[model samples]
Target chain A: MKLTLRVWRQKNADAPGAMAAYEVDGVSPDMSFLEMLDTLNEDLIVQGEDPVAFDHDCREGICGACSLVINGDAHGPERTTACQLHMRSFRDGDTIDVEPWRAAAFPVVRDLVVDRTALDRIIQSGGYVTAPTGSAPDAHAVAVPKPDADHAFVHAECIGCGACVAACPNGSASLFTAAKVNHLNVLPQGAPERESRVLDMVAQMDAEGFGGCTLAGECATACPKGIPLQAITTMNKEWLRAARTSKR
Target chain B: MSWTSCGWPPYGRRMALATRDRRPPTVRTLWDSSVGKKTVMAVTGLIMLGYLVAHMAGNLKIFFGADEFNGYAHWLRHLGAPVLHSHWALWIVRVGLVVSVVLHGVCAFQLSRRDIKARPVRYAHTKARTSYATRTMRWGGVILALFVVWHLLDLTTLTVNENAQAGHPYENVVATFSTWYGNVVYIVAMLALGLHIRHGFWSAAQTLGVGSAARARLLKGAANLLAAGLTIGFISVPVAVMTGVVN
Candidate 1:
């Protein structure tokens, strides 16, 4: 098989980049997307040319490190991470355009690597259990309702890929941040730090320069973990309540 | 200066609370942020709707004759509890209305900006999945904002093109509506306002957790009815005046 690639090339964060075209032959349909890229890189190395720089680890896709906006859709159109995307999804001789997630907060670290440390900052803002961090309470002590526990589990599956941010028109991470907020905020253990958790996470999200949510539901559609959009609704409700009741 | 120097000796011993920064998430998490804005949008939107209803009802009083209509206006200004002048009440209402409008607009603007920044590139398949009005709400909002300013200047402050002259307020309304250009402006603005209100009314309800199937149906019906009623009521004032039916 043959494929034409228009891949973004940048030397470093300060360098200007554009799509550079390449052609690879003898590609196999069975190769995963990254496997195909590996084949292309092998050829470039033999030819004494710089190999295309991309990010991927645990090509099985759970790491959330394989971030790419392929053919104009984040993580391609497979509803999964870029690492999980298979070459069979594309036709031979097709031209694939690859670019990094374009967001001010998630600056491009290299060709495809972005500094998602802001996401860590957002998480560190209060997405945690503050119950003295030392002793474990009995699991049965907290009596979490079945539905709430199920919802918390759903939000907890987020891999922090920033795909929601990339897919959003406002470059907003409400979906990602809300998932984290809702995950912890819903649990019995997270109750003690609820007010402070929401406040810190929200502040960190804004300080990182993300836009507010418009509730388009695209972030949910693009999510690899299938995080629900309702988490945002929950966050908004909590924020309003916090603002009104915290007059003291 | 020592913390205790001002008179409260324990001021220095007081600890600063480690308050968390709690701004709502950008529209990326629209569902989460939906609660606060939903409340604001719902409450404020309802207030604005109430104002519109009262305003139209007041305008309708013109059919009763100048003395009756003036008396109606005067009564609104004077007939409240404890004989509070309606103007004072009106001013208070106006302030509340303005606050609501600001909150609604601010929430929407923040959400829209986040949406724009989230996906800088236009989606290739957006047309198939999204409604035209939903997609264009941001631009429509800007138009409505501009329209609101012009509307206030024309009706409230009588500042239409700086040609506001002293005369009967109703006569000024009649003269303005009688002109072909004025009718055009009013009609255009009213149409946009109708579209803006159409989506907003029910959506605001939905945002504030009004998602029961029956409640959804009720809200939807009410929104359409309100939109249609307001459009026709406001438009009728201009139409009746222009056709010389009021005279």
Candidate 2:
């Protein structure tokens, strides 16, 4: 398949970026989106032209490292990470637009890579359960109910991909923050620091200059992990409860 | 279990002296957070929503003719008269409503600016966002604000209302709705109000942390009901006048 790619390119973080079109010939339909990019990059290297820069690691869709707004969708037209998105999803001779995640908190670092360290700072604020630094405890030591464990696991799927922020018109990180909060807040082991976990993480999220949740559900739509929008409501509930009851 | 539930940071509390030196997070500090601002919007919006329901119900009194409508208007000023002075209860409600409106508008303005700033750049390929009512909320709010001004001038102050007279609210309402521009403005604003409430009511519930997947359908149904009921109820007055049913 020969296709036209309008890929965003920038020299560095301080440099301006624009869509630079490149034509790739003989692209196989079985190649992943990143592999297709590899094809284009090889040709660019052969011609001594600077190849487009993007983020990718693990390439298995779990690292949350690949951040691309392909064809206006977070990962692509499909519901998976960019690395897992195959070229078969597109028609032959199609034109694709590739760009970085758009959010002030997740500013574009170069091409399709945005600094998502803001999310790490939010997790630092409290996204954890308290345990002494030692060897792992017995799995059955703490008995969490089945429903609660399911709830925790459901939300724990968030990969910190920042697609929620990219898809959100407000560029809000509510879904990301909610997933982190709910993943731990539902477990028996997590019950100890539940209140502070919510409060501090939410405060950190706000401090990072991320936008507020408007409940538009775009975040959930773009999320590759299928983190439910209800995660946000749960976070809101936790935050409110903490605000009212937690001594802090 | 967690640091003896002192609400202090457990790791820091290991010092035993840190508890005395550290300040706990309070509602005061929380208010400065974006979440708190949203709470303010949610609360104020519910206040206004409640008032709109009552306002629409009161407007329905027009169907009972000038006596019931005029009597209801008169009763408003005399509300709580035995204990509270004449117009005192009315003034209190007026003040409360003013406060609600001001706070709601201020928070909406600030949050909107922040929301826009958070997403500084736009994607090259854009897609339409959310529902029409959801996307149009900001402009709908602005339109409602301007409409409130016209409504007050036409009804409350008896200014801009050409055929206005004192103490005859039924007649004044009829006169206001009697004109072409009046009907046009009233209908348009009422439509905007419906769209606003459709999104705003559900959004307020989410912001207040009362919404969940289980309650989502119920809350949405209520929002639609309220939006439809109020719009139709309020627009009935202008329709009544235009059709010479009230006049």
Candidate 3:
């Protein structure tokens, strides 16, 4: 298959970027989106031209490292991650536009690579349990309710690919923050610091200069992990509970 | 949980206290986020929606006759009389509504500016994933605002009402709706209001943390019912006047 790719190119974060067009032929339907990019890079190397730079790791899609907005969607037309998107999704002679995750917090590092440290900062603020290293506890020691465990596991599936932030019109990290908040806050292990966890994570999220959640709900639609939009509502509930109960 | 060197410092004792102390007062912090503004919008919107329902119920008295409608309107101003004073309850309600409207507008405007600032570079080819009501909320709000001004001038103050009659609420309402332009404006504004409430109620549920996956369907149904019922309720008077049913 032949395809025209208009990929965003930039020298660095401070440099101006624009859409650079390239034509690639002999594409196989089985080739994953990243594999197609690899072929394009090989062709570019042969021509002594600079290849497009995009972030990808563990091409199997679990690592959440691949970030590309294809044809205006966070992870292309499919609800799956960029690494999982195959060339067969597009027809022959198609023009695909690819760009980095655009957000005020996620600045373009180079070409399709963006600095997603803001997401890391939010996690750092309070996305984890406070349990210290020790012998593993018996599985039945906590005895979490089935429904709460199920809900927590569902939210725990988030891969933090920054798609939620990228896809949000407001660049809000509400979905991402909510996923982390609910995943732990629902479990008995995370109950000790639940209130403070919501407060600190939300504060850090705000400090990172991310936008607010307008309930536009594009983040959930763009989410490759299938993170439910209701996670945000749950987080809001947690925040409200914490805000009212906490002394501070 | 396994610990990895992910570049961020671990959540430590001092760090938690430091973060907590650094946080501003609860109210200031609450108003700082988009979520905060949305909460304000949702609460205030509910307040206004309540007033609308009550007002609509009052307006339905027009069907009973001139005495019933005028007497109902008269009763609105005279409620709590002898115990309090004439128009005191009405003025309190008016003041509450004005405050809600102002706060809702300010929060909406600020949140819009923030949303625009978040994405400096627009998408070349965009695909909408939200509902039409959600997308058109700002425009719907503007329509409702303009309608409120016109409605007040035409009916409340009798400034824009050409066939204005003093002290006769029923005649004033009928005279205003009797005009073709008046009907058009009222009907159009009612439609906008319906759309606004449709999205606003569901959104308010989510923002106020009252909605859940199990109850989403119920909440949506209620929103639809409220929007449809209110639109029909408010438009019935103008339609009745235009059709000579109330004349």
Model 1 - which docking category? Answer: incorrect
| Best of the two (2, 3) by TM-score | 2
Per-residue error (Å), model 1, residue A177 = 1.5
- Estimate candidate 3's alpha-carbon lDDT, on a 0 to 1 scale: 0.88
Kindly list the per-residue Cα lDDT of model 1 for residues A1-248, writing each as its tens digit: 89998887777888977778889888888877888888888999999988878878787778888888888778987989988888889999899888888777787777777788778777765677756445877778779999899979999999989999877766788888889888998888898767767755776777677776655566888899898766776776666555544432
Q: Residue A246's C-alpha lDDT in candidate 3?
A: 73
Q: Candidate 3's residue-wise lDDT over B1-247, tens digit each?
A: 1343343365442233223344566676578766667788999999999999999988999999999999999898998888869999999999999999999999988877777777788766577777888888988998998899898898888999888887898999989888889999999999999989999999899988998989999999999999999999999999899889998
Residue A58 CA displacement from its true place in model 3, Å: 0.9
TM-score of chain A of 1: 0.95
lDDT of 1 by residue, B114-233 (tens): 545544544322333334545556777778778788788886778784445554566667767867888888887777667666777766664554434446568768878887888887
List DockQ for all candidates: 0.20, 0.47, 0.50
Residue B28 shift from truth in candidate 3, angstroms: 3.1
Estimate candidate 2's RMSD in Å: 3.5
Candidate 1 positional error at A238, Å: 1.4
Cα displacement (Å) at residue B82, model 3: 3.6
True contacts kept of each: 0.22, 0.59, 0.50
lDDT of 3 by residue, A1-248 (tens): 99999999999999999999999999999999999999999999999998899999999888899999999999999989999999999999999999999888899999999999888878876888877667988878789999999999999989999999888988888999999999999998998779888888887877777888877889999998889999999888888787767765
Worst lDDT run of 10 residues, candidate 2 chain B, spans B12-21
